[model samples]
Target chain A: MYHLISDIIRQSEENECVFWEIVQQADADERGVSKEESFETMRKMYQAMREADEHYDPKVRSASGMAGGAGQLLHEYNETGENICGDFVGKVMEKAIKMGESNACMHRIVAAPTAGSCGVIPAVFLVAEEMLHLSEDQMVEAMYVSAGIGSVIAENASLAGASGGCQAEIGSASAMAAGGLAYLQGGDAGQIADAAAFALKNMLGLACDPVGGLVEVPCIKRNVAGAVNALTSAQLAMAGIKSAIPADEVIDAMRRIGNEMPSNIKETSLGGLATSPTAQKRIV
Target chain B: MNIFDVVGPVMVGPSSSHTAGAVRIGYIARKLLAEQPRKVQINLYGSFLATGEGHGTKKAIVAGLLGMQTDDERIPMAFELAKQQGVDVSFGEANLKDAHPNTAQLILQGISGQTIEVVGQSVGGSRINIASIDGIETNFSGDYPTLVVHNQDGPGYVSAVSTLLTEQGINIAYMQLYRSNRGGDAVMVAECDQEVPQHVMERLKQVDGIGKVTYLGMMGDE
Candidate 1:
């Protein structure tokens, strides 16, 4: 029953189990269910995430008629031979856009932390599984790892854009995805925490200013950015780079920054890019 | 927090707080009414009022009142479905004080001429809080099998309800009682560890001074 990432790490080292196993066991104990039952629930969630990612229809526009076809456009661009990010990164970006666009179109999606930032973890996990040929069991374990990181952040900081900003929404999702990716690559618990810390630190004050108070404009593109950031952070952690500040302290800083933020920069759609003339013109 | 709170609650959504959570608030209000409402007045507040239409908050609420789950793909067509079902629905804005941004006040009139007024808030991430019932202040998250009993604020009502639940082996996880005035109308909100059987509800309704008994099983519990 660890409420903090630091505690989960310490307990993992003490029990001589990987981070996912520790999380699995702790989840069973907390919910008073068997470990097998807990794993079964995660399996269902993973299946849902996979279904959303695979069933993308880029032609479906948001109900607000704000975002549509961008995911299809990105996929087409990636199919061309002129892409610079290579096939692996391109695939990651494609899945992220698909997930975000799917959410905007009112398709079923797992709120990996939240719906506005739902694309980050699924994008990282699905792309990693395809490129690395990981099994279903491995993907499920990675979800457990991601859940552990998200629980800590949600307890220590805020995950709602209304309470914090985009830094709390997409920022937390990026951190969770980074840590999960590190675990899937066989990094230690400390390295996983480091990856999360780096990813969160990089997005400390990103504002939440969805144009027209809708989750379609900057929110969709931001999911793609979060996925890429998670991949980079995981790679750095695997290479033994350490964050100067610990993971828990980084979450505390996020909470502090969220508290200091003005409500306009939160989910109110009053400031930042939401106030730009281009964004304001679409309010009608 | 459990793993589901982090990685799950599969829902159809452009926004969880606005769409999914709105569905839950409406669903719970329907349950509290104990029947399908003949007419409903939904008052969206704060962020729900400012941006609800674009996010389909109204449709989500109507879908929930029709007993649809959060992930039901039929949500987008809920307004039309309500018309087919003969459910009169109207939307308006409310100035709720000190409530969460995503709040809705539902006024439902049931077929039996009984009315229920519920104030619910979508805190975030598909979680909801039933902030008040009628004019009485109360609090309970709709995560458990809950029983809300409206009765006269006289002696022995709480004991009577708790005693019946105990006889059925239902353990109360949390309980709160709120009243408008002394010896006047009161409500008891009990969240139980296990499901309260239909017989228990019928038995409670038969108790002296008990006006209405509402059982809201966990979301999707039906």
Candidate 2:
């Protein structure tokens, strides 16, 4: 029998999360501070998370919300030669539309380990790459580290919100992204692990309950959140703040919270914003 | 040495059940035909048939026939590319009994006038099993070098076959001997650590119980 766990970790490296961890370790060593020293790092990340939350001003002024078609934005940025952030975000959103367009795409789009969350890693990684001028090798390495962390969470906790809750879904994605970022930004394997655990722990008990089963609504928005959380966690870990709570303890909390959450808050589309009168009316 | 034991696949995905699974079904169908197909027909069954179109099932089938992996981003353009590569495609429906919901039947015709029928299912994450071929019951996952032989049930057939492999220095990773009954229809699936030699195949055909010998080679390796 094949060892599925080993295969998953190997594939995660093939996908580049492992090398990302290496970069983080290098940076952490350069700073002469352990990732554990950044114990209060998560609190600062929370503030960044709040700031990120406010950035999605999805209106006419907000390029993120333009309805004429966001698809053109990526191509437009690529043509205009602005920062790839605009181009990258546009690409992520375009992938989301393409994903919705065909069912047999078989992209295995990593969901909160979910399919929708697939873009989150790419989004944050792309941003980091552009900002830090990291090489493709570094990005690939980070992805492997991220994959390792994600696979562990998948094995020990749950990536499916239905199984554990949104905490597992988006939270897991955030954690994996954080681990990836931390690794890329110069944290050690242990610090990378801590950063990941901290990210997931902070977001534990998030609900799914997408207003529509369609991968729109909160799905796209959550991608933004996942990206921001990952970067924030990396920054905190690099700053030497460690999560006081153990990673395993946080996973347990996520599971317990998920169990306590009603099914409506899962993927059932029964509660939360999914059941709002406006959301019900908007159902296609 | 099951076919699934060796090969790992990469796939595109919203859901593996919906997307990657469909693509694997198509890829195997194309490979079974021996020649790149001129026209392909697919029948979706159960949940696969029901929600396939929504999940890009049709696109996946076309992509698979063109030898694309599930994770390959080219799946969306599979049809246009297949046309460029001189393959035609169509779809229909079929219901299989007690099968996984993600299942399909593919009937393919090569430019050489040869036809192949394949029944398969996508279990999850783009993994699939080739359930049957040409109304004959067969089980194959495209992971190994397999020789699927249909023969008459006779005494000492197993020993003869094993002896031949031993003589040839071929390691029999797995030998499954299946027979309908005594002196009746029988089939032996020999999955090997390496490809079986043509001489070995010829020797197996000369055995008393052997009737037909078809070397499937490696699944999906053109």
Candidate 3:
């Protein structure tokens, strides 16, 4: 029901509460569930996301043979104290790959918005568990923030690659993650809104070009980028940076741009990297 | 859109449109048959054919026919599962004119001699539409509790079905009716707010002019 992030923010301010409370109450109203029931549902979702990451099986390969041991490789690299990214981020990147690989291998995954972009929020939460020592309740609160932002994107733009391209899928995930990250770090509603806006605007017009029409190739790696992008946006917002355009306007732009995008790049796998010379050779 | 629609629908993945959505089409096809499927022929059209192999659309569909949910870990091994369950499954490329790229047609034969043909489209974000059932032009997304009623075209057929639903205290959310020709075969697609009970469906079948009443009550949780 919250079509704009500003709406959620305004409601939160008026109610003297955090963003998740506003979103959670709205969920309660929409579903006709009690507040406790709605939060319980969200808590179960967070648990499922965590479980998907914790139970990742690196031994299993995707049917296409493209994504399996990469998460293991990243994990080993993160442990060596030799990675280019920080230890926390390296671990986050590691989880992102594992979750997406689990998805490809047909293991259970919480498709936050969509299955292909499933890794971003879980990656952030996984790293938060090990590094920041967040509790289950705190993580569930952050999930509400992400869900709120994702709801807006789903309504205004899209969460399907076929509809708006990767910009809508991974792009929406990044924004949702950014808002959640901002919430976890105790940023105000404006900061959370700016973080989501910053993340989404950065990924505007990104294409959904998986090789051979599979959610591998660039798709798996894009989850990593989305997780990393969310982190950057959250950090910028906490540092008081604001998006030039409002968050709602950015989402509207995503809708217009997605409509303007051709079907080839919109998950048809006919163009973009899906048709690249090297990508063509790698198609399963 | 529901907030849950944004956050999660815990499922097996890769491509929601190709993989999870394919599983749903298979699941619905199984439900429509109203019995265990002894044999199923799944025909993929457009992108479902061009790249369905990589997406494991065949396996996903087979898993669905085997009564597996979208998040079932056995999805990758659906072919094996189908064989173990003694269900005959076959796949072929289809040319569904004017259908969406991610479409599948399933011809199902049940254990008790029941049969139904279903054409469904994976219309992105893991949602699907049962566009055709048994050569009849019907369109409905399985997002609600639904009833697919087959009846001879009569003045009171629609009222008869709605009256039964009304008797059960079930509110109708959406309804669509289709018939091949006037005064011939007709179908009424009713999506309800409450689950349509089995006895109500049985009673509907016994009603005058009504043929078969197939129901789909609630979706996505599984």
Q: Provide the DockQ value for model 2.
A: 0.22
Q: Taking the tens digit of each residue's C-alpha lDDT, what string does model 2 give over A52-118?
A: 2222222212111212133345335556766455654544444333322221223333332555465
- Model 2, range B1-222, lDDT digits (tens) per residue? 111111112335445555767877777676666567888888888767755654567888888888877667788778789889988787887856887666788888888887877788876444577777665667777656667666787777777877888887878777776677777788777778787777887888787767666565653356
Interface RMSD against the true structure, candidate 3: 1.1
**Candidates sorted on lDDT, descending:** 1, 3, 2
Error of 2 at B200 (Å): 4.5
Output the number of the TM-score-best candidate.
3
Candidate that would win on lDDT: 1
lDDT of 1 by residue, B1-222 (tens): 877988878999888988999999989898888787899999989889889988889999989998888989899899999999899999898767878778899999987787988999988788899998886887998888999999999999989998999899999999999999999999999999998889999999999899888889864534
Candidate 1: tens digits of C-alpha lDDT, residues A214-281: 98889999999999999999999999999999999999999999999999989888899999998888
Candidate 1 CAPRI grade: high
Candidate 1: stretches off by over 4 Å: B95-99, B111-114, B219-222
True contacts kept of each: 0.82, 0.25, 0.88
The best-first sequence of candidates by TM-score reads 3, 1, 2
Which candidate do you rate higher for DockQ, 1 or 2? 1
Tens digits of per-residue lDDT for model 3 on A114-170? Answer: 899999999987687668777888898999999999998888888989889999999
All candidates: interface RMSD: 0.9, 12.3, 1.1
